[model samples]
Target: MINCDQTLSISNGKMKVAIEGCCHNQLEEIYKTLEHIENGENIKIDLLLICGDFETIRNTEDFNSMSVPAKYRTLGSFYKYYTGECKVPYPTLFVGGNHEVMSYLWELYYGGWVCENIYFLGYAGVVNFGGLRIGGLSGIYNDRHYDLGHHETLPYNTSTVRSAYHMRKYDAFKLAQIKQPLDIFLSHDWPRKITNFGKLDDLLHIKPYLRQDIESGKLGSAACEELLFKLKPRYWFAAHHHVKFPAIVYHDERTSSIYQSEEMNSKTIKNPDEINIDIDEDLENPDEINIDSTTSQPHISEDERRDQIPCTKFLALDKCLPGREFLQILDFPEANGQLEFSYDEEWLAITKATHEFLNLSFNAVSLPRESVIQSKIDPELRWIRENISQKAVGLVIPHNFQPTAPAYGEQQTFILQKPFKNPQTEAFTRLLNMSNKINPDGQSRPQE
Candidate 1:
C-alpha cells in the first residue's frame, strides 16, 4: 500500500514547462522572455501555466467588464490571438483572477478553450498532463462570500462584477473531495501563514509592507491554507500578492527535502522569533491526519507512518512587468512524455457525482452536508466504472474548441453581451449528462 507521503505515479519520460505569474496582458514581453530563456539554455518549453490575471479581454464590452480603474483598463494583445491575428506559441492554461473579463470565463465555467490551444481551468478542476495530475482553483477567496453560491450574472453591477470572481464554496468543496494525489496545484492567492515556512526576513527585505498583514494573520487565503493541508500536493505554485517567494511545507515533522532555490536563504534569514507566525489547528495536525467524516478520502494505507517524508514545495511569482521575477521554467523528467492531455478518472467521477449539488443561487448557502454528497457518489461511481472506465481512450480530453461568441473586430470597442452559452462547455456537460448550470443570468436554469 502506498503511504501518505507518496505521490501519484509519474509518466514514462519528462515534460518541460514554463510557469508564469500574473499575465497583465503583456503577451509580447512574456513570449520574448520565454524565447530568451530557451535560447540561452538551448531547450524547449512544452507548456505555459499562467497563475491568474490573464486579462482575456476580447472586445470593448469585455474591456468595460474588467474590474480595473480607468487608466489600467486598456485591451492588450489577447484580442489579436483571439481573432487569428496571432497564434499562441505554446499550449497555455490559466485560471481566472479578479481582473478577468467574467463574461467570457463564466461561459466556460466547466473549463473550455478560450481559443485554439489556450484552456481555462474552470472554477476548480483536475487533469493530467505528461502524467502529472495537475489541479487548479481559479479566482481569489473572500471571507464575506466564501460560503455563498455563485450569485453574479452577466451585465454585472459594480458589486456583482467584483464578487463574480470571488472563489465559491461549491468549487472549493469539489476540489477537497479529490482522493487521487496531485503533482502540481496552482492557486492565485498564497496559503495563509505561508510566511512561516519560507525566509521571512528576505521577503520583508523587499516587500516590507507585508509585515503588518503577516503579523495580524490577515494576508493569504484560509481556503487555500485548508486545501494545502488537505491535499498535500508535491508542488504548489501561486501568484496574486506580487512577489517571488518560495517555501517548503513539510508533512512529516522529522524529515524534509533540500529543495533548491531561496525559500530559505544561504544559512538562515533570521530566527523564527523575529517574525511572529501563528501555527494554528491546521498545522498542529500530523501527516496521517484522518478526515473522520463519511466523505473522508482514505488513500494512504495502514503501513504509512515514518517510511518517508511528504512536503509541498511552494513558490509564488510576481506579476508580469519589467524588473519583477515573474517566470520560472521547471522540468518534470520523471513524467510520462508518451501521454497527451488526458482526463483524471477520479475528478470526472467526482464532477458527475456531485453535479446535482452544484449550486448557482445568489445567496449565502451552506455546502450540502458531506454525508449527502458522499451518498450521491457511491452509486455514480459504479456507472463511471462501467461507462467511462471501459472505453478505448475514454478519459482523453477531446480537442473541443469552438467560438460561441463574436470575435474582436478592427477598432471594435463595443460588442454584444455574451448571449449564447459557450459551445465547448455545453458539449462537456452533455458528455457527462450533467446539467449546464452556467448561464447569462447568475441563477441556474430550470431542470428539464
Candidate 2:
C-alpha cells in the first residue's frame, strides 16, 4: 500500500487511474472488470496498462504465429475488437510478452495503434499521456540471443517464431538513453532479485513451489534489472510471473552497471600522451583539452558527482483469473500538456545498423535475377548485402536444434495443462485480500 498523502503530493491534482495485470486474451473480462469498478464502485479509470501476454490475435492467420500448443490455437476476443464489432472501453496500452502473436506486433516495431484506442508499445518505446512520461520494454530476457540482431523475417519459420520473444540488446540500450524522469515503466518480466526488497517469506508461504527458483535466483530478467537501476521510475509494473508482489527500490544505494562500464572505458586510455585523440572544442573555451599534449585526469570531490536517490515502487500482478487479485486502480497526476509519442533515437540507429547487416533478399539463392533487381531498386537492402552479408562468412545453424520454451521445467508442464492455473495466482489473491482488509474502503494505506 502507498500512502495517499505522498502519492497525491506528486500527482499534481490529476486523477490518473491504472489497471495493472496480464489480459491473457481476456479483453472482455478486463473491460467488464473496469465497468464494475467504475459503475459499481464509483471509481473512474483514465488509463489501462496491461503488462503483457495480451494475445492480440486479430484473426485466424495470427493464430499460427502464437507460441501456444497446436490445439489451443484460435483467435480470441481480439478478433471482435479488430473487426470493429466492439471497442475498447477506455484508453488502453500494452507490451508484448512471451505468449503473443509476434507477426502482428512486428509490423508495428516502432509502436503504433492496434485499434482505435488501443496501443502496442512495440519492441521498446516512450510516450506521454496526460503530461506524464511513460516508458516500456516489451518481451522477456534470454541470454543466448540478447546480442543478436532482429534477422527474423516475414512468414516466420518455426524457430524464428520462438526467437521473437528474446529481448535484444539494442532495445535495452535505447531505454538507457532516457535521462528524463519517468512516472511509470512497464515490462513483461520482473527485474532479477527484486523479491529481496519485499517480504520473501510472505511470497513463499503463498506459492511454496517457487521457493527453489527464488532461493537459487533463477527467476526474472537481468536486462530488466539493469534498466530499473538506470531509470529509477516512480512506479514499475510487470506480469509474466503471474504474482502480485510489490517491492520498493531505493536507487541511491544501487549504482548502475552501465555507468560503471562507461567510467572504466574512459579510464582505459593507455599512453594518452602518445596518441593524438581528437577532442571536441568547447564553445566557451576551445582549448578545454589539448589534443597535442595529454593532460592529467582531474579529481572531483564526492559532492560534485551526480546522485540518484529516488525510490521506485515495483508492482507485478497476476494473469487474468476469476476471484484472483489481477487488477489495481492507482491515481496519477495529470500530464503537463497534450500527449505525444516519440521513437527512441538509439533504437532507430540500431534498426538501421541491423538493416545494413542482415537485410538479405529471400530469393538470393534460388532466383538470382529477381534478387538482383529487388536489391538494386531497394537501396537499403543493397546496403545491407554489400556492407553486412559478407561479414557472416562462417555462420552455421546447429543440426536438429530446437529453440527452448520460455517457461522452465515444471513451469513448462504447468502451462501445458488443459485448464491452466498459474501457481502465483492464489498467493496474489491472498496478498490482495490482506491489502483490502488493511484499507477496507479502497483508500491508500501506508507501506510497511
Candidate 3:
C-alpha cells in the first residue's frame, strides 16, 4: 500500500493504526510482510501508512539514465504486482521522502510516470483512513534550512547532508502547516530529543551522528519538534532513526500552546506542564523498561492487536486477471541478460506511463526495430494495435533467418510496428525502407 486510511472499529475498543517506515524500493517485500502481519492479527487493519523514501536513487542523473527495460522490470513489476494483484486490508497512505520527491523531479525533467495508488505527497500531506486522521512529512528533513544553511555546497550535496539536515528542515516546515489534530504522524526521521543527538561511537550504543547535531543544537526535525510543541499528536511513527533509541517527551495542553518565548538573560525552553524523557526504549516492544505507557501516558494495548474488518476490494478485470497467474518470461535481445521470473503489473504500467505521463515523447525517439517483446507480445499490446490501431512500437520481434551469414542477394528483415521517427506516422516504414528489405509474402517475424 502506498498510503491509505480506513476506519476499523475493533471489539477490543482500541483504534488500531498500522504505519510502515521508509520502504526505499522494496515494495514486494513490504507487501508480503504486511500480508503476513494481517493474517496473524486476525483483524483487518484500519489504515496503512507509509513514510517516504519509497524509491531508491542516489542522484538525478542515475534516475534519469535508467534503461527503459530496467525501469519496467524493477519498479514496473512491483507496481503491477502489488497494486494490481495483492490483497491489502486497509486504506493505504503514501508520503514522499527524498527519494519520491527526487523521482518526481526527474519526471519533470526526464519524463517518467509515478504510480497512481502510490501517492506522492510532495513535502507533506494529510489523509483520512480507517477513522484516523493521518498526516505526513516526506522527503529529507530541513531541506529548506539546509538550503539556507549550506549555500556554499551549492552544486553537489551528499546524501548525509540532504537526508539528515535539509530534508529534515523541509519536513519541519510542512509540519507547521498542518492545522488539524492528527491521530497519527508518519515521519521519516525522529523528533527532537536529548537522546536523538548523541555521539557516533557504535560501541557507545549511541546515535553519534544525531548527537553531533544536538550538540550543535541541530538534532531532530525542528518542524516536527515545533509541531509537537503545537499540536502534540497522539502517535508519531518515525523511521529515519533506524538504530532504536526511543525517547518520549510528555506534553500537556499548556506545553502544546507555547510555541516559543524569551525569558531571563539567555533563553529558557520550558517543558510541557508535565514532561519526562527516557532513552533507549522501544515504545512498540513490551520488554524495553525505561518508559511505560501507564504513567500519565497514552493508553496502549497489551498486544499489538488489530481487528479484522470487512474491506472493499476494487478490481479491474480488463487490465488484470484476479487469482489467475499472469506470468511472462521477458527476453532482451540487445543485452546479455537472462530472463527471470518476477511479479507486479502496476510496475509495468508505471514504467510505460512514465514514458507518456511525464511527456517524454518529445525527447525520446524509438524506431520499429527497437520494439521489445514484452510490450508487443502481451495481450494488452495486441489489443491496442488491433482495436485502437495506435501505431507505435510497443514490443520488439526478431526477423526470421540468420542475419550474420545471409546468402548472396538474399535480404533479412525484422518486423516492426512503432510510430515513425519523423512526422509521418507509419508502422513498419523503417523496415520497408531498409536497403535489404525482404519480401513480405515470403518472410515472417519469429513466432513467440
lDDT of 1 by residue, 1-448 (tens): 2333332221222577778888888776787777665564567777888899998887676765678987888778887778778888888888888788887888888787887778888889987877778898988888898888776776677898898888888888889887778988998888888887777887899899999999999888888888898899988889998888877776754322322223422111111122111212121222443323367566552234333557687878888776566776666776754445667777877799877767778776566777887777667777777777688867777777765445556544334444346767777887787887776343331122
What does the lDDT read for residue 42 in candidate 2? 56
What is the C-alpha lDDT profile of model 2 across 1-448, one tens digit per residue?
2321132111223454565578788888777766765554455667788899989775454555778888867556876676567877887888989988775676556555666677787688776666566788999888777777765644567887787777886677657655667888999988988877665665777778888877787778888998998888888889887776766665665443311110000100012122212323221211233222445756442222222235677778787776455776666644444333333322333334332223122221221242443333345334434543435531111111111112111122212111112122222223212221111121121122
TM-scores of all predicted structures = 0.82, 0.63, 0.43
Which prediction has more favorable lDDT, 1 or 3? 1
Consecutive 10-residue window with the lowest summed lDDT within model 3: 310-319
Quantify all predictions' global Cα lDDT against the true fold: 0.72, 0.58, 0.34
* lDDT score for residue 388 of model 2: 38
Ranking by lDDT: 1, 2, 3
Per-residue C-alpha lDDT of model 3 across residues 1-448, encoded as one tens digit per residue: 1111111112233344444555556555455544544454454434445665555332222333222233432442333322335433334455554444242222211111133234333344444433445565654455344333212111223542243223433224334534456555666655554232222243135445555675675655556656655655644555554332223333433322121111101111011221111212221222222226558865543221111211111100000122211111111112221121111122222222222212111122222221342343354434434533333532221111121111112222322221112111112223222221112222222332
Instruction: Report the error of model 2 at residue 110, Å.
Output: 0.6
Angstrom error of the Cα, residue 374, model 1: value is: 2.9
TM-score of 1: 0.82
| Candidate achieving higher lDDT, 2 or 3 | 2
